[model samples]
Target: MPTILLIEDEAALGMIVKDSLEMRGFTVQYAEDGEEGLRLFRAALPDIVVADVMMPRLDGFSLAERIRAENQTVPIIFLTARSQTADVVRGFELGGNDYLKKPFSMDELIVRIKALLGRQPAAPEAPAGPLPIGRYRFDYPKQRLHLDSHAADLSNREAELLKRLYDQRNQVLERTVVLRELWGDDSFFNGRSLDVFITRLRRHVKDDPQVQIINIRGIGYKLVV
Candidate 1:
């Protein structure tokens, strides 16, 4: 069973979400503010985190940034009422793995979680050359990534995204090209979602001393190795 750390300012809604997730076989630790959320994160180190963006004290963005700095691979999902492109981009920039708009359905949230958790890309017939993502060896054809003694499975989307970055290593990969190639659209939501995936890719290579994905402000991203 997966343990979820839920950080939301609304007490009533928190309980509801906790109860709902528990019903779905997930253990949950609830925090009503970002400060408490950060404390719980350090103490428990839950599998996935769901946090509200507008909480008092620390705020979700700060909490996610701190969490990312501490743990590169732990997944974070932001829950926010604000749907502006800037806010969504900011959330992704802070290392958010996903986001849910306020007043969302529980079922949709569950599906999103399942998708994020279980997404897998079809393996390639041949490896994508000698690509070393930091300490990890990316076997793009097989959709497998190995780091140290551990291995991580990459979804098709993840692999494709990483492949593109590797192809454009050391320079900016245009945001529009990335979106059109990977997601087939350059809509605001797609852009926001791309940020989440970028965060994930960053986490995958965070341990590598020679690899980094640098955001090019309003333009695109540069993958330096």
Candidate 2:
């Protein structure tokens, strides 16, 4: 059985998630606030985490940032009621492995947790190479990207996206394919969410004129250099 740290302030929802996960053969430790959640998270270092965005003592984003600073590989799933684009983007920026908006079904949460844990094997160490995008260089082994003598910190999702695009350079990456590969599903909502990340990447590489993210009509995006 896998272990899960569930950080949720709502007593009813926390209990429901706890019971549901335990019934599925998982050992769950519940935390009602961010501080205790972080303490338990470090002590137990569970296989996965399910956290709510809003909490007393500390918000989900701060807790997640702290965890990511220490453990970059642990899986995290964020729970939030707000559907705003900024909220979603911030969650991903803070190293959330996945996101489930509020009012989500229990079944969906279970499926997401299973999918994340199942994909662990596929996320092998990134290949060793100097990934060149225009004048910028991405050293995958070192997890560093250099641009004009300056280094930029690429988040996990950013690194993943960059790797995929670089792997399929000069090729048309179907929107659905990228979504399923990166986000697990290609729902319209997720599509829009993906667009936000794409936008952020565009901003990150704005200095490189040769780096282009072309949007194909009703199709997908192509990263051309």
Candidate 3:
């Protein structure tokens, strides 16, 4: 069974989550604060780390940072009530593999955990030529977007999302479709994550005025070139 280190300050929620995961056949190492979480993490390395952003000792971001410094491969998921785009981006920057907003369903959490666990290390492959998008060239294999003289490296998720958008460029990439395909469900928390990614993609292509990822409000997005 894959071991999970769960760091949550709220006693009730912690127990509930711990019980739920244990019921699903996972070995859970539960901690009520970041300090305890870190101790547990060091003592018994876990397959994955699920931590809340706000905690008594060390916050989730700090925990992730420390973990990343020691082990770069373990997946870290942040649980936070804060929905600010900056907060979400910060979590990713701190090496968090995923973010789950508060009030999230147990089912959604389980799906995300399973998805992360299911990922296999990709093998090396030849780099494919760049695909043109307005004035930008997207090198999908390298996960890089280049303009005239600048290049921006994209996360794996970002590259996948951009490719999906490019595939449906000039047409609406239905919200539900993208959510289900990329996140395994159309849960509200996953939708929030998608919005953050969309915002990041827009920033990536912002240098090219001709490239636009228009939000279809309540529907999805359209990449107009």
- Highest TM-score: give the candidate number: 2
Q: 50, model 2: CA deviation in Å?
A: 1.0
Candidate 2 off by > 4 Å = 118-163, 199-218
Q: Alpha carbon lDDT of residue 198, candidate 2?
A: 75
TM agreement with the true structure for every prediction: 0.65, 0.73, 0.62
Better of 1 and 2 by lDDT: 2
lDDT of 3 by residue, 6-120 (tens): 9999999999999999999999999999999999999989988999999998989998999878876577889989988788877876667688889998987887787666542
In angstroms, the error of model 2 at 168 is 2.3
Order candidates by lDDT, high to low.
Answer: 3, 2, 1
In TM-score terms, candidate 1 sits at: 0.65
lDDT (10s digit) by residue, model 1, range 60-139 = 99998898778756777889999998888888777676778889999867765654443324222355464786677888
Model 2 C-alpha lDDT per residue in residues 43-123, reported as the tens digit of each score:
998988899999999889999999888877577889999888778877876677688989988888887787666543445
Show the lowest summed lDDT stretch of 10 residues, model 2: 116-125
Q: Go through the candidates in order and give each one's C-alpha lDDT.
A: 0.80, 0.81, 0.84
Predicted structure with the largest lDDT when compared to the true one: 3
Worst 10 residues of 1 by lDDT: 116-125
- Rank candidates, TM-score, best first: 2, 1, 3
